[model samples]
Target: MQTEKYRGYTLWGHAILQQEGIPQPAKFAGSGTVTRDTKVVEVSGVLDAFDSDEEAELVGLSWCRAWVDSHG
Candidate 1:
């Protein structure tokens, strides 16, 4: 899992479909600057294990989605 804190908000991410040890390149758009309260973290890698029924980027997207849902 990865945690990115921004201001007073904390963004926590988890690799639900991580198959490998290294995470794939993901494009993340967030507001604010990178500081003690704001940062980006890559949790895990994408591998063939997720080729069966899981999506690679969906894990991160889901976390973002949930964050939006909760905030909005």
Candidate 2:
């Protein structure tokens, strides 16, 4: 998992590997959280699979940006 701070929001990227019937080598899951004084808001999502963690982290960042823009 990788975490990044952006625009007062904390964004994190989660990479999972599934070795079931079909192997999923790289799966990207994202979560974002923001604290406003005493309240906290959070969002999470699953993105398309990527070959690298960096790409997944980028998607997580984008999702966090959109979430903040819409929910902030």
Candidate 3:
């Protein structure tokens, strides 16, 4: 697990295992938006390891959950 700090939030990287080829790393980028001193984190980024956009979206959601746990 690797961590990148972004806009008061941390972006984590996880390497997806591959069976026959090189595995690409999934990047989770997030930022905190403030409204009346309340921190609302918006996690959005791409998962380059995915073969398709749909898969990327799925991976993004997983990253979102992880991001929320880490930042919330």
Candidate 4:
């Protein structure tokens, strides 16, 4: 998991390891959360399947950033 502060909100990004039984390529699932002053603002379900943990984590963070921009 990774965390950052953006525009007075806290953003959390994570990568979920793919199970052994799952297909290849999409070896990680991306997700994220957004909070303001410890209060939950938004959370994302599995954003998408990614090729790597880093990719998933970045994607999740990007999603959260976009959310903040759009809602602003």
Candidate 5:
């Protein structure tokens, strides 16, 4: 997981591992959370999958930023 502050809101980007113990390389799914103060504002569904944890987390962060901008 990764964290960032955006416009007074706390955003969390998570990379959930998938396809563990397989012949192929592991995959990660992107998800996000948005919070204001100590309250939860939003929790995202699986946004997409990526080749790396960093890429997945980046996607989650982007989703969080867009949600905050559009809803705030």
Candidate 6:
């Protein structure tokens, strides 16, 4: 997992590998958890297709940024 510490939130990204039940190919998944003294809010979802592990991690970071901007 890749983690980024921002001003008011902590973002994490992980590469999803091919799983048994998941039909789609591997992709980047991201989650953001608020770090401030607000109510606990966590958001997670798939970001995009995975080209490489490093690329997937970057995609996840980007997704985390968007999520935090909208939902933080």
Candidate that would win on TM-score: 5
Q: TM-score per candidate, in order?
A: 0.27, 0.59, 0.36, 0.86, 0.93, 0.61
Q: What is the lDDT of residue 10 in candidate 4?
A: 91
Evaluation by lDDT, superior candidate among 1 and 5: 5
Clashing pairs in 5: none
Instruction: Estimate, for each residue in 1-72, the C-alpha lDDT of model 5 and write its tens digit.
Output: 999999999999999999867798989999999999989999999999899999999899999999999998
What lDDT tens digits, residue by residue, belong to model 1 across residues 4-49?
5443555444344333445764333222111223454332233223
Model 3 accuracy (lDDT, Cα): 0.44
TM-score for predicted model 5 compared with the true structure: 0.93
lDDT of 4 by residue, 1-72 (tens): 888999988999999998867454458899999999899899899998887898888988999999999997
Evaluate residue 36 in candidate 1 and report its C-alpha lDDT on the 0 to 100 scale.
28
For model 3, what is the error of residue 16's alpha carbon versus the real structure, in angstroms, after optimal superposition?
A: 19
Q: What is the lDDT of residue 29 in candidate 4?
A: 93
Which candidate has the top score in lDDT? 5
- What is candidate 1's CA lDDT for residue 64? 55
Give each model's clash number: 6, 0, 0, 0, 0, 0
Ranking the candidates on lDDT from highest down gives 5, 4, 6, 2, 3, 1
Residue 22 of model 4, lDDT score: 46
Model 6 steric clash pairs: none
Worst 10 residues of 2 by lDDT: 29-38
Clashes of 5: 0
Candidate 5 lowest-lDDT run of ten: 17-26
Model 6 C-alpha lDDT per residue in residues 3-48, reported as the tens digit of each score: 7776577666667664545665554443333344555456455655
**Candidate 1 wrongly placed segments (more than 4 Å):** 18-72
For residues 1-72, write the lDDT of model 2, one tens digit per residue: 666666776666565543344554644444444444436566565666666766766776677677778876
Please identify which of the two predictions, 2 or 4, would achieve the higher lDDT against the true structure: 4
Error of 1 at 23 (Å): 20
